[model samples]
Target: MNPCDTMLADDEAVIRALLNEVPFNGWTRTALRRALAACNRDPDDAAFLFPGGAADMIETWACLADRDMEAAALAADLAAYRTPARVRAIISLRFEQNRPHRDAIRRAIAVLALPQNAKRAATITARTVDSIWHAAGDRSADFAWYTKRALLGGVYTSTLLFWLRDTSDTDEDTIAFLDRRLNNVATIGKTRKAITDKRPKLRIPMPGFMRTWAERA
Candidate 1:
């Protein structure tokens, strides 16, 4: 077994234990210590495993969720659906994957919403939206790449907040809300293309920062 793979497995084990305690203790070091104990990991390893403390733990968990969502998308044969439908399905799948950890997610949002964690929050959101687009089979290497992720980021964020408060059975309300938002985006895209069709074509170069991000993606 590779050292990196061993480390990831250890991280996942501790984090999975951490989730069980997050609802009761929030994302504090105390909860993490307990999680370390539960996983039979040395309590002192907390610092070594998550040097950024709660933020690192949350980010790792989000990364795990992204991988799970990608696996779910592939298993679902997302290629059979249209792009919009594929996006919707992927989002829905994410909600389902995190359904059991809803409270932990709420706590995570609160932590990420803090003024100090703004950059981490944005990074996590960007990664998640990018993952969703990739899972939906988007291979665009142009300006639309950024636009699509930005658009889905908004939809995913809004739906996530709505989902945290949703009481409808099986997230029926959240799914409907997501569908409406996706439809609105589609409508706007169509209108913009129609208007652009009548104007002179312009090539917009991808920004340096976005290009860097794309390369990392």
Candidate 2:
């Protein structure tokens, strides 16, 4: 394997171990040290592995989760489903994959919610939604690309918040909530399409400022 791949695999191993401690230690350096020890790695290696400290560990864990979600989506052959259903499946897969580490996720959310971690939080969200869209077979490179990700980002975040609190069987309620949000976005998209169809001249290009904003996101 490539050296970089090996390094990332090692990092992921440490992060996986870290998840076990996060629920009790709340993503602190102490928790990371314990995780390293659990992995039979040097505790001092924590600084080299996650220089940004707890926030870095949280972000890495999230990115790893995104990769897992994407791989699962692909393995499930989502091309047979409609775009919305495909997206729904991808998001559901994410929740399912992380269910075992829900408390770790909750703790990570608390860390990410800090005012200083705002940028990191946004970056992680953008990456996650982008992964979802890609896994759903979306190949749009136009303005729709940005809009779709932005719409899904809101749906994803809201569904996530709801899921964290949901107590229903098998997260049935969370899935239902996700379906409703997806349906709403679909309705809005269709309405906008209808309007654009009726008034060709109304199909305006994405604003330059908005484009810049989307790029940053």
Query: Which one is best on lDDT?
Result: 1
Q: Pick the candidate with the highest TM-score.
A: 2
Q: How accurate locally is residue 114 in candidate 2, as Cα lDDT from 0 to 100?
A: 94
Which digits, one per residue and each the tens of the lDDT, describe model 1 over residues 42-137? Answer: 887766667777888888888888888999999999787999999999999999888888999999999999999999999999989988999999
lDDT of 1: 0.86
Per-residue error for 143 in candidate 2, Å, reads 0.8
Candidate 2 ranges with C-alpha deviation above 4 Å = 1-7, 201-217
Alpha carbon deviation, residue 56, candidate 1 (Å): 1.0
Model 1 RMSD, rounded to 1 decimal: 3.9
TM-scores, one per candidate: 0.88, 0.89
Over the stretch 1-217, how does candidate 2's per-residue lDDT look in tens digits? 1222234777888888988998898898888899999989999877676777787777788788888999999899988899888999999999988887888888888888999999989988998998899899889877678778889999999999999998875889999999999999999899978866766577667568877865775
Residue 81 local lDDT, model 2: 94
* TM-score quality measure for candidate 1: 0.88
Stretches > 4 Å off in candidate 1: 1-7, 201-217
For all candidates, the clash counts are 0, 0
